[model samples]
Target chain A: MLFMRFRHLLFAIFALASGAAMAQNNPLTGLLRSLTNTVAPDQGKAAATNQPTSVMGVRGLDEVALKDATPAPAAVVELEKYAASAESATAAAKQTGLQERTVSYQKP
Target chain B: MTNFRLPVRFGVRFGVLSLIAILTSVVCAPVSAQTFNLNAIGSVVSGLVEGARVSNISEAEEIQIGKEISARVLGAAPLVKNEAAQRYLNRVGTWVALHTERRQLPWRFGLIESPTINAFAAPGGIILVTRGLYASLENEAEMACVAAHEIAHVNMKHHLDLIQKGALTQAGAKLLEMRSGGNEIKQFAIGQGAEIFTRSLDRGAELDADSKALVYVAAAGYDPGACPAVMKRLAAMKADASSLAMLYKTHPAPADRAVRMEEDLGKLAGAPAGSGLRPELATKIK
Candidate 1:
């Protein structure tokens, strides 16, 4: 009876430990795995090429994006145009918003 | 001739003594007035007083006065036809106004119906830009530099402060008010203030206004260097003697203003490099 109870307790402890580890590794899991491989000379190129640019808040995620992602020239220009349009709209809205007074003074 | 000598000598002596006493009295009276009113310099020729309880002159009495003055001036002058130019100027003015320390002042902008290349700010936030000013401006920054100077006049309460300090006597204020057909009391206040501004003409008001304006211009995300360039254009325009009179009568001449503005520009740091002047938009001026 004692041996059976002890075995069940051990199994429960193992499961909890594995769960905690998985949660901690979730966001940065892929990046960590790739970095670990890069440290190994033979595995570096293979892992680096396969690594994704975007990840869910993983460590060094922004740096990975800078290294791995390439935006098309046309896409960049389109994004800039959108930004310019938004700024222009904001300026125009401010200009048209004011109430102009109609009163006038005569010249002496 | 021989019979008239004694009487003539006595008359001449009396005249000389009277002149000396009159000059002495004239000199002595102002010293007393100046001593009592530390702000006597605040008054203008129009007789408006400052230190009146009005929190904002432009919002208080200047608005009505500005509109009235703008209307009368517009009647005699012709409006510039370029809608885009008007819009552009308003945009620049608005940008500067927003960045100024007195952003809450209900600043109103307008293009006056005149050919003179000048801009003047009446009491309140009434800013009058002329067609000639529009034609001369190279960019938004230039427009703002001029507007900022006008804004300083309003923000500093140079006019209203001048009046309330009793720079214009009760009688002086009433006389000028009657001439302008405005409320004699209000006109009195304005005239006194105008006197202060006129006296400051040779003083540092214009240069100080220019420096203050550059600060606002830069804050509004425009290049501060535009101030010197705008003054350069004004200087060029002033070369025409006919144009000089109108511009000088309202605003100070551009002759020394540009040089001093340039000197100030050199001392300033971190002003932006280039401005985008849309010639297509600018040339739209009539």
Candidate 2:
């Protein structure tokens, strides 16, 4: 009976170790992703077509994702374009001395 | 070693208790005693756990991006170049920034010529305070409070982290700094996620910035009582004008911040004999 009990304890320990390892591997760090994926099937298309490119415009949808796990792809595409444009602009600026034309804003 | 082993149940119990103790210690560790130069272990830990991930890019890359955006923004709509205000804000920001972890960064401070009531921190120690926010402030302490919080954002690398995380772009943080004449980029970046992240600083991040700002203002020998009063005034301003009015709109309302400030007042009550700004001088800036 003692040996059987020890075996059961070993299994529990092993289970806990595996759980920890799985958690370490998880990428969803900031907040837990809800399990139930009852996401609305077709919202990204509507948002992309209708929503203005403003922070507030997308916030309602972000809230939905937080509350109901409804993901929107429109935000992803917009963000990508924005980042790419900024990166290119920055690169272009570096190619020339574009940074020099601006008068120093700080006091000498 | 002698073959002495505990029962499996005892071992498991002991391990669980040890883990709990270690976690508690990690969470409860005080902000370091040394003049926390900001990149020390304590600050990095504080940032990782509570700092706002304002960008996803590397700090060096973010600084480069910030420099690029700042150059462009200033080129189009240059700061007023009012030497008085520039010197004043820089002096105050320098006081706060050195007290933070990322003190070594080439931080620059400026005042933009705009009526909009806002202040913001960009990557690489770049801070911009609009003439509007400056006019609204009643005293140097209030001004310091605002500057310190922005400095905390820089030190915590919140703006840069957000950009890297793809939540905010390099242009977005710059837009926050130069709101007036940045064209559509301002409107565009705001939609990119700055507003949501701006308004809702996680409770921990807010508290961390508050704590550091308070400590910095107090250490600089400004009136410690002034920080709380400034927060209360901002809360009132928000309540009257809708909370989103502040340039650095925090998600946790100013009232919530005021309450926290009140709770921390006891620790910051002692005023050192030094002075921050001459109110008379501050108002005299043309």
Candidate 3:
């Protein structure tokens, strides 16, 4: 039982350490990417001015941000003559699964 | 100015008391989880001050105000006749709007026929991007960038709040006592709204909108760098070009906005690239 307790504690510590590691890996977090970074909005503001090209070095905008934005929920509006005939398109999407629904974050 | 400060002054005593309470909480509680929710405290404090309202414009009235402004825009420049492009823009815009706090709003999108690179967000949820600006977009990410900035204006209620404050300034406490802005006041506010749009929002608000735009694009899975990239393109343009005259007049320099975007841009660095525009959507944009 004592060994099990020790194993549990070890697991908990590892889990927490990994979580911190993920946060540390975040591109936005700067030199001080720890819990202490939240204390001063002013310092955050000051740090912001010199960030980007200064901190990260100048990089191509396209190559840099490729932010992994989560796939957008399918847009509420349908496509291609959708508004003109919503009922038909809705039926087509439901029945034949052929209507083209668009989203912001399309899977490549 | 007198009217502007009246509503806030009524809560001065409560505000001070809350300040003390906040300070005490900060001293006693841990900074993370124990930190007080300023919004929750605000609601509690507001519950005590029922009479302190700056102006009362219902959502319907706000929408009406926006429609009036939108109608004026349409009166000036007809919407582009490309139905496919129109629906495409709506699809992109509505998708971006879903990421915002005010997603439930009846968002409407339009592409007006103008060569000027401009976009406008009216009081409610009407967003119009000019054809010139639309043509300038290299891809859907750039289109989303334009839509998100205007959406940010609506989400933040920047223009609506400005018009509300303007109406109060003109009509004073009468707006408050009336409870809701009456039709007459609404019409007057709409007129003021037109004039306000002709000018520009304050510098801070514009920069705030830029920051919000970056976040919105990122949230919607578009490249957040699209903002700075667009700004860089604008920066390279001749400011005196006829198409850019009104845009230049109403907005701060593109270089300044690009500087403002740097902070948020840093956050986007090394992030996974989002999806590219679908081929059919790309064709519509081109």
Candidate 4:
């Protein structure tokens, strides 16, 4: 009876040990472990670096680029003309009814 | 024998119970303990459901999209014919961009021929300033401020984000169904993406870009104040002017921008003193 009891105890121990080993090797457990160990830290690092979350929404500037841009010669001439006009407009607007709001950058 | 059976039974029960406890703990742990695992599962499930939908735009992809947009822009208004002016703008833009985190991007700068007082930034580091806006600047510092502002938009991925959220998501979905039909869907998406430039970014984004532009120009050792100076100029423009209409529509009022810049200036007081324009570049602009 004593021998039989000892054998049963050993069998039980073996069964328990094997069960634990199998559990440790389980794919789900491995995935969970990797997610906790790897993905979490990567996210933390990305956050710390202030990386952008997504880049999908930026495509709209083409229309602006197309609609607003002119050929270089025309653009340059127009720019020169615009500058002269803008200066005169500023002078005119100041002399007339429009009030000029001065925005100065003072060191605080 | 009965005693042996009892010990074996108890051991089996204990082991099974421990396994159950571990499984339960994994399932029922506090969210903080399990969030990563849960997110992994969610990503896998989403990947399966969304099939080929890209969650992030790669750098190569950004360049491709930028190229398509740029071609359309060139179609609308070609680059300034002056090689010297183009080179000068590139030099200045590259100088400012080098000071940014995304310096590795293939930075290209152009002067558009438009008389409109506006600037544009395409994804993957393409920047264009209207000859009109460029001509209005008094010095390189002012030009740097403008370039920096557009650079900020690229760095911040402002346009890229708009495309992704609006057209790209739909395009990606369609591309999966019609693999050989991808080009048509992509072109349609690109057209839709271009339309976003006509719309205004949320006020917060424009203001944020202003703040970032200030920092970038200051970092590049240009007067951060140049940005506000430009804002003041824009604010002073007649709202009824046709040239000013598109700019005003797409941006916050210059008065509001000036106010924001005024607030930002205080924080930038400690930045290094800015340099003036190089004599050669000054003469070239003249």
DockQ (CA atoms), all models: 0.00, 0.04, 0.02, 0.05
| Candidate numbers, best lDDT first, in rank order | 4, 3, 1, 2
Model 4 complex DockQ against the native:
0.05
Which of 1 and 3 is ahead in lDDT?
Answer: 3
Could you give candidate 3's per-residue lDDT for residues B1-286 as a string of tens digits? 9887765764674465455554433332322221122222223233322332324667787777877776656555656778778776776677667667787777778876777778888877888787888888776667778888899888777787765554333233243335443554465456653344555688888887887777666666566666777888988999877677667766899988988886656654333444222122333543
The TM-score-based order of candidates, best leading, equals 3, 4, 1, 2
* lDDT tens digits by residue: candidate 4, A25-78: 344543444344333545432321221122222222234454444323333223
Residue B127 in candidate 4, Cα distance off native in Å: 0.5
TM-score of each: 0.52, 0.49, 0.57, 0.56
Number of clashes recorded per candidate = 46, 21, 2, 20
Better of 1 and 3 by DockQ: 3
Give me the TM-scores of chain B across the candidates. 0.66, 0.61, 0.74, 0.72
Write one digit per residue (lDDT tens) for candidate 1, span B147-198. Answer: 8888987777654554433322322333333444434445534433212222
Against the true structure, whose TM-score is highest?
3
Best by DockQ: 4
DockQ of 2: 0.04
The best candidate in terms of lDDT = 4
Across B154-217, the per-residue lDDT of candidate 4 in tens digits comes to: 9988886665543323222333335443343334335543445665777888998898887776
lDDT of each: 0.49, 0.47, 0.57, 0.59
TM-score between model 2 and native:
0.49
